[model samples]
Target chain A: MKLIDRARMKSPWVLHYNSGSCNGCDIEIFACMTPMYDLERFGIVNVGNPKHADVLLVTGPVTYRGARVLRNLYEQMPSPKAVVAVGTCACSGGVFRNCYNCIGGVDKVIPVDVYVPGCAAKPEAIIEGVLMAVERMSEHTPLKRGK
Target chain B: MAVKTILPFGPQHPVLPEPIQLRITLEDENIGQVLPALGYVHRGIEKAGENNDYPLNVFLVERICGICSATHGLAYCLAVERLLGIEPPPRANYLRVVWAELHRLHSHLLWWGLLADAFGFESLFMQIWRVREMVMDVLEKTAGNRVIISVNAIGGVRRDLSEEQISEMLHTLEECEKQLYALLPVMLNDYTVKKRTAGKGVLTSEQALRLGVVGPTLRASGVAQDLRMTGYAAYGELGFEPIVEQGGDCYARAVVRARECFQTIELVRRALQQLPDGDILTKPRGNPNGKAIVRVEAPRGELMYFVVGNGTKNLERMRVRTPTLANVPALLEMLPGAEFADIPVITLSIDPCISCTER
Candidate 1:
């Protein structure tokens, strides 16, 4: 079980979803994977489909239409998954909190395990976010293994 | 018997950060037609600007679109400054140029990463973004905020760069240019990338002009037009002809941007060397009463701002003409003949920011 936990911590494949964001955080999040910050050294890969993903990196202030898409995608991911809400918009609705279209922060639609806050959080912060999410995921699974 | 097939490209597609829906009419995976429906994240920020005081409106406008936030703030300040007849210090003008080009680099690096993702060149996406981070770090160090630098004000910018800071920024940008230049050839001449992009979504010089595509899109189509040439800010002091490419395809657009990235680094370094000394801002004496139209080059394209201040605290009306919105009709024209699998890749060529457009 510890081995599974370690492997998940080491090689968590991510599926990023934007609930409707300004491109600031979205671009910063991508910057995390670029050559300088290179998250691949941690063995993280951004997979296209949610079903094969282990972590969900969400950005933006979830809008009304985005809420439906978010739930549909969240449901598609297999079990044993964690959601990391990146950027201020995803965490507390940021500047768009009172906008006509926003449906509040991501937590309104799904359970979020970790929150990284910034108008657009930096790449360094996003890397820290993925690691923190894995730590929280470990505490949730029970200690005893069934025979 | 015919069945209407539906495919949802994004709210989470690799090529874009904002949620945009394109319902494609497909005949067995061959795209028969495409329809785009935006307004997913419309914040009604334009209306918000009308309510907020002039000072507060500056902050609100910066959130209009994250990628072009600084430019939005710049255009708004310019419009308001014109109304008040305040010429910021000479140093402020040069400082604005430095930050604006830096913003251009960050924004273009972002667009480059998305372009790589659209083509499924994930590693390249990562590579470009890594370089992009250095520019953001520069922004943070200088402006004290990463995305919304909030550097520009109606009178002038708030922060000033010391000689040491200026030298450090110059050094940092030099390294970035070297690293980015090393990667440009592969992105331009790589076999697979060219095969995918070269002829796809061909917009000839004439077609681009007809559609009124601005910025790199127009430049790629061989139009020698750039609002920067209009001598706004200190651009006239550091002169260069427009970067033009003849092909007008996805490949040409990519070339135009790659070249501009290098040019921007040159511009920033030059501005630093020629950095003038003076006051940053001067308080305006009277109320703003007239409407004004201010145009500037945003990272994506030509960004124009229209503001009508009614001699009071609030603006009578405010309008933003975003580049993505102007280029949409052009993108719609490019989509019809493209292969079904290339829809996302081709659509992304315009660097769509639905939030910016819908605002």
Candidate 2:
């Protein structure tokens, strides 16, 4: 029972959500799964369900319409989940910060544990962010959403 | 009497990654109506374009669609250059074609892999993406970043290709093309692939013209109207022709893209062979002033950029009409009669880029 958190990190299923990204970070995140990057070798599977996810990878500046969906996705994930804001936009709204529809970064909608910063956040950075998220997620008490 | 069920297919879905909800009304397992609800990724980039300095807008527009950012950057540069009345040097023109073709090759490969994934062809998907990685490597080797290389500058490309880089790129392209051919039997001739894509979501040439569809979608429907024919950049000198397939169905669209991959490879080879030896940049004296409308062939279709400058750093108005936006109507037309099971496959067939559409 004590090792459950550690066990969870061993094989974490990731859920990727694109709130309002330009598809830059999202593609890099997807590229992580390809043969060259081979993220699956680490036992990280990109899942579609929020319930099955141990970590959430979000890309883009949260737009007004996407903010609700972002919050909804975060709230639905089981406790002890970690959110990694991938890309400059998700970390701090990047270039889309001043755009009319943008509501700023992912932190505005959900508690982000790690920030993977890049215009398109390279696949290496995204993989590191997910791993960092795994460590951070394990540190959570399993009772609360964020510490 | 058949009862209709309304189902929302993403702002978040497994098959199509980016968020664009489709309100699908199903009647007895067949899709009745699919109204695409697309406000999720709308960051108001057109408005943002007007706010940014003309030089900076190149980067901003590139972010509009990461998959084809290089093409987007090229189009924006072409537009602004026209406004400034200064042409990029000859070497810059040839280099632009090389990178743009590489961009198209990768984008089509990505779409090809995604289509395979959409139809549950897992191993095929992985194989195609593996080949795509070679293109990414070339882009990184010559330019720097993988996806958004930002090689494009105001008057010319930022990076120049070395002879070593050119030979290495050609070697990679040769290997990639061979791998693509090995996969072609399964992608085209395989019964399963055909079952999923053949005669599905067909848009006849007339309907295609009426819908104002662009890119492979139009080419699939037998319309040979690629903006590249108008010969922007180095396409004129390269003697390019649109890859047209007459099937006009989902399979045709897939075939158009598949055939286009080979054409793009040849284009890159030709452009590299004819690469002019000269300075790449021709420095612009002052801020751009006047109106310029430029359209270039993006991976998806025709990407149009209209910039109106007032002799200032910031443009008075910058309007971008992305290929995906033009193709959405064609997608809407194709969805009404498709089975629920085929929705994902049909959607993938168009290679829809919701980010580009909404941006």
**Which candidate comes out best when scored by TM-score?**
2
In candidate 2, the second chain superimposes onto the true chain B with a TM-score of 0.99
Checking candidate 1 for backbone clashes, the offending pairs are: A34-B126
In order, the B-chain TM-scores come to 0.96, 0.99
Model 1: chain B TM-score vs. truth?
A: 0.96
Q: On residues A1-147, what C-alpha lDDT tens digit does candidate 1 reach at each position?
A: 767766776788898887778777877776677777778898998887888888999988888888888898889997678999999889988777777778779999999999999877888899999988777766665532321
Please write out the lDDT profile of model 2 over residues A28-88, one tens digit for every residue.
8878999999899889999999999989999999999989988998999998889999999
Q: What is the interface RMSD of candidate 1, in Å?
A: 1.9
True contacts kept of each: 0.64, 0.90
Worst 10 residues of 1 chain B by lDDT: B8-17
Q: Give per-model TM-scores.
A: 0.93, 0.97
Those runs of model 2 whose alpha carbons end farther than 4 Å from true positions after fitting are A2-6, A142-147
DockQ of each: 0.56, 0.85
In angstroms, give how far residue A134 of model 1 lies from its true place.
Answer: 2.0
Best by DockQ: 2
Which CAPRI category fits model 2?
high
